[model samples]
Target: MHFTAEQRLDGGVLERTFTLGEIPGILWTPASTSAPVPLILLGHPPLGLRTMYPRLVDRARRAAADGFAAATIELPGSGDRPRWAAAEQARADLRRAVAAGGPVDDHVVDALVLPLVEKSVPEWQAALDALLSLPEIGGPVGYSGGVISIGIRLAVVEPRISAAVLFAGSLVPAVLFEEARRVTVPLHVLLQWDDEGNDRRAALDLFDAFGSEEKTLHATMGGHTGVPQFAGESAARFLARHLK
Candidate 1:
């Protein structure tokens, strides 16, 4: 891993941009301290880092203020990375189905999300390896935000993540429901009750499927991107309860 840039943000947070192999990523650390801080992996949609920067930085800063280090890596076929033709086609199909105002076909959801889960989970694991090697970042780790499916996969496969805050803002393919049953870490799931892009019933079912002995589903009344500030504070408290 190689860092390409570094800057200081308000509140004594240090922000650095880096690349691991071909994947671009960003890391934010709180003010210098003698002890290494617990890390939060800030998960986001495949919406390219440039498009998602404002929100990602905001979340990172919050984590910093809460005495944690945060980091995020671009997903496969997203940001400045090379694109996949099959995924592109799957996206087009999904759009067409949504525009038609009919139920999205099972095949379309599988095509679009399954491959993404298959490719991106390993990349996130690799990023965790590099981030943990840094002097300023340490474990036990927490993962916050989504694609919710990716978070589910990570929770099941990446044992280093002690807790997770998953946003139910995207459609989860059926296969991941089984994986959800394998997630044994504590989870805080956020759901936007009026999300236009997600299936509310499926989101609830997914939450019910989690095998974790401790899991909370925090649902709020809003559309996607309308999560209240207090909701984030609640999530931070949940992470602190476990990661700290």
Candidate 2:
């Protein structure tokens, strides 16, 4: 990661902007963190990181306050990375299906998700690589995001991420359910019961696929944007237990 800009936020959170070959990312560290702290990789909605800016900032800030270094990079097709010619088409297809109140087909799912998986997993790993090399970051990595599929992938393949907090609000492909079985790390999954556009069955199925003996499912009553503030506090406590 090549850092291009940086500034300190309120509460002594150091925010640094970097680019992994045009992929913009931010690294956040708390001022009180004098020693190496656990790292967290934050995943955002597919629309882009910008759409989730408020929650992202809140999450990052809360994590930093709890003495964890939180970070997030732009997802493929969302940031500085050039979009594939078919990217919009894939999105439109999924949108149409959702608008029709029908399930997105396997082909559409493959088109929409395969590219993200192919491109994003490596980028996140790269960000982890670069961040882990810093003296201020190390050990017991955690991941938090609503992009639950990506979290599942990372939990399966990235052994360094010791714990994760996943937001269950998407339709994951069946193959990913298989990959979910490979994840043995501790997980804390949050499911907003009435979240719009969320496939509750899929979320439950995906949660069931996690092989981790330590996985916990947090179900709350709310919509996508209606998640209660207390949920965040509970999640922070969970991360603190395992990460701090």
Could you say which candidate leads in lDDT? 1
Error of 1 at 214 (Å): 0.5
Candidate 1's C-alpha runs over 4 A off are none
Query: Candidate 2's residue-wise lDDT over 30-64, tens digit each?
Result: 88776899988888876666776677889989998
The window of 10 residues in a row where model 2 has the poorest summed lDDT is: 79-88
- Provide the lDDT at 197 for model 2: 75
Clashing pairs in 1: none
Residues 47-156 of candidate 1: C-alpha lDDT, one tens digit per residue: 99999999999999888888899999999889899999999999999999999988899889889999999999999999999999988777899999978889999999
**What's model 1's overall lDDT?**
0.91
What's each prediction's TM-score?
0.97, 0.95
